[model samples]
Target: VQPSTFITHVAVLTQPSDGTAGRPLPRQPVVAAMDAGGNVMTTYTQPVSVKLNRGDLDSVGMVGTRTVTFRAGVGTFLDLRIDRAGCCLHLVFEVAFGLFRGFSEGFC
Candidate 1:
């Protein structure tokens, strides 16, 4: 991938969900992509394939929607099922357009 054709900035978002009995509170994993100049590209409407691990999974992104498209430069993965407490999320974003293999780590 060219230097100018890669995602320069990757951001992760985590939301704390109220816990219920016998379930891990699911949280949506949100990633933001930006250019080298740090400008968020809202026009990058592309379905980005992402793999998420060791994090919470919001019910919205579950069931065939683990891979999601970016809307307004932010892609929200609703199927993330986080494992364990005090562990950071590991995510890899690939394909779909204008982005290379980018890794983002976040603490929720």
Candidate 2:
């Protein structure tokens, strides 16, 4: 399957349903985008200016997810960071082949 476009410099805030409270926040990390061929397409070092505050709950807390989009090519990789309640999280994923194939001799 073709890799989805890279998503960067965006924060996705989510809330849990366990009525739990988290700690203070930290400095946000930069976002990185990768092309389909696994090349660095772009980087987002701008600090995200958005903030989400969820009051103490019995089973809910806010969670953030960032995305970076890039043009299609061959392979892909991405780096993301999330800091909340004095905790930090990082994620990276590699994209393999895609669904669509280029024009070949027989098909054309």
Candidate 3:
């Protein structure tokens, strides 16, 4: 296999699910580096960062390690949480080496 395949973007493998306020997400988020054909680019091992996408200036804060290193092209955010109750919140995953970004499904 040609290690020449480049990472074109990031993808959310698992979407976060609703959970109690101040508690970890019932389903943690998972992200992956992807090739142009949407295949996991396992050769692309780099740190991916996640952040809360707060559309408005609310006091909502995300609690967890903001960055995770890719393993076999995937990164799982195990301890992600919301500091307060909210609806329609989303998480954005990014990699600094490129213009890649992935958005998670809306969750409470």
Task: Summarize candidate 1's per-residue lDDT along 1-108 as a digit string, tens digits.
Answer: 222445565555444343332344465557666678666666677666665542544322212355788898888876454433433445566655535556655533
Better structure of 1 and 3 per lDDT: 3
For every model shown, the clashing-pair count is 7, 20, 0
Identify the runs in model 1 with alpha carbons over 4 angstroms from their true place.
1-9, 13-25, 52-64, 82-89, 96-99, 106-108
Using lDDT as the measure, the top candidate is: 3
Per-residue lDDT of 1-108 in model 3, one digit per residue for the tens?
Answer: 444378888899899999998899999999999887878988777899998885833788999888999999999899989999888998889997547899998888
| lDDT digits (tens) for residues 31-60 of candidate 2 | 233435544434422222222222222233
lDDT accuracy of residue 82 in candidate 2: 24
Q: Which ranges in model 3 have alpha carbons more than 4 Å from their true place?
A: 1-4
Query: What does candidate 2 score on TM?
Result: 0.23
Question: What lDDT score goes with residue 57 in model 2?
Answer: 26
Candidate 2: deviation at residue 88, Å? Answer: 9.4
How does candidate 2 score on lDDT? Answer: 0.27
TM-scores of the candidates are: 0.54, 0.23, 0.91
Q: What are the Cα lDDT values of the candidates?
A: 0.55, 0.27, 0.87
On the 0 to 100 scale, the lDDT of residue 44 in model 2 is: 23
- Cα error, residue 42 of model 1, in Å, equals 1.0
How displaced is residue 25 in candidate 3, in Å?
0.6
